[model samples]
Target: QGVKVSGKTVTIGAATTHYDVSTDEKLRKACPALAHMASLIGDPAVRHRGTIGGSIANNDPAADYPAALLALGATIITNKREIAADKFFKGLFETALKEGEIITAVSFTAPAKAAYQKFRNPASRYAIVGVFVTKGKDGVRAAVTGAGEDGVFRSKEIEAALAKNFDAAALGGLKVPAKGLMSDIHASADYRANLIAVMAKRAVAAANA
Candidate 1:
């Protein structure tokens, strides 16, 4: 998912306070997860108003962009330097952005195959448990969002399973441990852990289909 700020079209510079990357035809084709996740952000208004840069920069625990960025191995470009997605996210509502540095755009190389599945909070449309899976030249990557207490994180277990065989059946009987997951009024940590496995399976299935 790449973020470029412009008035009405995609560009490298900033003029408009916000730009909708979700509707970009090229982006939709390159990374379906970007379009899918963006469409699921709140409702129509939020989708149109929220910028991709704004969402990733905020790094909300339940935010969708972070998971996509991590799964796709995107690069976060700033005024000062570029940061890898794995290193960009620091913690809950935190990032590696330095003072006076602004995120100009993000560059993501679309995976050979990828899909995202989310169990969302009905009212807010935010993911209570979201999983993004990608299988490409680098390998298989499984990233979970809205479930980590620290924020989005990669699931090694799911990734390992997918690496062996990129199919939903390969993940059968495998589970992500509940440790370090978020437990709140919405869903418990253990429940989120379960959702991670289920969502990952669905994501793999979708990618294969």
Candidate 2:
């Protein structure tokens, strides 16, 4: 329920709500992109009610946090052990958390630049395709949510493009293959695929802004 800033690291308590995350002045200054992403999540009620830990523990494929965490190289701290974002998320509604282990906190080092973008579903505000891009200590990472059948994942193509140019123009002609993406009533696989590229480009532009 608290946000703590320690030099280069920011640690958010598990019970912290989306509203808190979005509004924290320290967080907004240290990680504007993450705060911006929190600001855009759900409506007022949902944001007020949704805790960061609950959201990530559930690991919803359309969830916004996972993409941001993954791209940011966040660490998921639990009562038992710590898990890297790269290995924390397994698939839809899945995580590396062992039975009875509860998430205690999440922490990440602020990146040089980062941003998140999503094409939302009008009814639920869930991302039809969400992208979080970052240029940080680990280099470039672009993670996608709401599109993968296996759940949130990094877009290697987007990473390579951004690493090369670090601009929206870098994604020009880049095509996200529909093969592993979702095809539900909300959107077809191809549409979500395209949105991945579009949102990634938009996120990069936003980060640069």
Q: TM-scores, in order shown?
A: 0.91, 0.98
TM-score top scorer: 2
> Candidate 1 on 67-138: residue-level lDDT in tens?
988998878888899899999999999999988989887776778889999999999989999999998789
Winning candidate number (lDDT): 2
Per-residue lDDT value at 80 in model 2: 92
Which residue runs of candidate 1 sit more than 4 Å off their true CA positions?
1-19
Q: Cα deviation in Å at residue 199, candidate 1?
A: 0.6
Question: Over the full model, what C-alpha lDDT does candidate 2 score relative to the true structure?
Answer: 0.94
State, as a TM-score between 0 and 1, how close model 1 is to the true structure. 0.91
* Model 2, TM vs. native: 0.98
Q: Model 2, poorest ten-residue lDDT window?
A: 156-165
Which residue pairs clash in candidate 1? Answer: none
